[model samples]
Target chain A: GAGVSQSPSNKVTEKGKDVELRCDPISGHTALYWYRQSLGQGLEFLIYFQGNSAPDKSGLPSDRFSAERTGGSVSTLTIQRTQQEDSAVYLCASSLVGSQGNYEQYFGPGTRLTVT
Target chain B: SQQGEEDPQALSIQEGENATMNCSYKTSINNLQWYRQNSGRGLVHLILIRSNEREKHSGRLRVTLDTSKKSSSLLITASRAADTASYFCATAITGRRALTFGSGTRLQVQP
Candidate 1:
């Protein structure tokens, strides 16, 4: 009964560099989501993947932000040309979608990305 | 654009006292959920209240939703010092796949 998990608890990189954050969802979870949280601010929805369907990338701020969920389990969020504004904690969550509806999401320890 | 907004950015209370936080959203929602975060890290799911549900309870937590007002409230009864954390309200808008979160309320429970 492991929960969602993320890699690189903290990452510090220079501006214009590219950074990738990874997430491993819980077993049997068909839906996965990524969100970003700035300091003293709320979480911003980034992208979502449901099963084999297309991923929802509407919330992504720019073209540089993109994510891919491979084999319906692990997801990787990559930010190209990272800017100072991209400095924030990246959170990943997963949930089960059943006949009733989408249930509560289980979140993983976020990866704090610092663009210096 | 942020859909949900929480009131009283911060609150302080003593252990055994109740804590109540409110959230108001801009558009209609399918469901509202409460989450708690510690040390500004990952969040933990607290409760979920559907649009049709007026109120729901889990342990010491009580959540209420008013679809007409597009608002929700989370009340923790007889709180403990361990409950000190940042609370947020996230809304799943109608016809939306992702949830929009509020700016959260920092609750400080003094033991």
Candidate 2:
């Protein structure tokens, strides 16, 4: 009955530093996604992972953005060489399945990253 | 590129009044979903309307999709103060893994 959860509700880091945001999806969820919301970018999809397949990284703005899901349950989004433009709320969501079918996604509270 | 665009960036209404928000998208979509977020927190799924279906209702919320126009509208009847939040429209494109979201509309339901 637990919903998706994220850690470090807020994070502040210096430019050029690396930051990692964590997400724990609901039980039985086979699909996970990460999105970013900023003053300038609004809300944009960053990455997606479905089952054991390769994750979709098309939305990742640059090579510095990377994510990994361990054991198909939890995911961590890492941003290297952070820039002020990367400052935003990092949100995570999970669904029973992937884009093959229409399903509702459960979202986490999100981690607000501030690159100073 | 943003696929969906919500109209009237902000809206204000009294409790018990109805509220309506519109969304327009650029490309064809398989379905459209509405989500509500309180403050800057995580989003809560409100409703989903498929391209084949013209309209759907859940509790006090009504959603209508016009695939021909690539647009949709969400109407909340008898809104309450608790309904005050930011509403967004997200479109699921064919063969796409992720949903594209609109800028969102801020609704303030005054009690």
Candidate 3:
């Protein structure tokens, strides 16, 4: 039921400020992911957490961007010294964990971040 | 920087017509997935076709994957006005847990 939920539906911040976005995954799902949708860039992967293992951070655009999943359920994405380029809709997704089995990711409504 | 790129950046068609969109990625993938997003709404997974599958169908949607060409296509037949939205193709590479999304094709189905 509860699909995926992201908090702070919309945010406006100064260019040099920092912001944190939150995500709550569906119950029983072990895989969680973060993505950014910019004006023309579509959806860009940010990071992912599977169980308690080290997250896959290959998609993070820069060192300023970091994410963490605590208790294998809630995740937070922190953007340091935000820039106009960092403004976008942050999306979260989750799915059941497995090997070549089910990989259908349920996505959240997303949080729109605006950096001025 | 992006892996997947979709064609026809935009499409406009009348209801009951067929709409087709194509996507091409840079690297080999284990599976390809299609998603639809209405204006201001979250994305909804339409279908997924593994690399091993050449074509797959679900209701009015048809997805075809051509690994050789590193491309995929989605066809929506007898589309309704409600079908107007942005369609995206995502490719999941082998060994990676994230899926790379394309630029997306905006389809406008007029009633």
> Which regions of candidate 2 fall more than 4 Å away from where they truly are?
none
What would the TM-scores of all predictions be? 0.96, 0.97, 0.95
Residue pairs clashing, model 3? none
- Evaluated at residue A63, the lDDT of candidate 3 is 95
Positional deviation of residue A72's Cα in model 1 after best superposition, in angstroms: 0.7
Per-residue CA lDDT of model 2 for B1-111, tens digit only, reads: 779999878999999999999999998888899999988879999998888999999999999999989999999999999999999999888888788899999999999
* Tens-digit lDDT track of model 3 for A1-116: 58899989999999999999999999999999898898755798888888978888988999999998888889999999999999889999988993342487889999999999
Tens-place lDDT per residue, model 2, A2-64, is 999999999999999999999999999999999999963347999999999999999999999
Give the alpha carbon lDDT tens digit for every residue of B77-109 in model 3: 999999999999988887777888898999999
Report the C-alpha lDDT of model 1 over A49-114, residue by residue, as the tens digit: 999989889989999999999999999999999999999999999999721234888999999999
The CA lDDT at A68 in model 2 is: 99
lDDT for each residue of candidate 1 in B1-111, tens digit (9 for 90 to 100) = 778898879999999999999999998878899999999998999999988899999999999998888889999999999999999999887778778899999999999
Candidate with better TM-score, 1 vs 3: 1
**Shift in Å, residue B6, candidate 3:** 1.0
lDDT of 1 at B26: 94
Flag the better candidate by lDDT, 1 or 2: 1
DockQ of 3: 0.57
Candidate 2 vs 3: which has more DockQ:
2
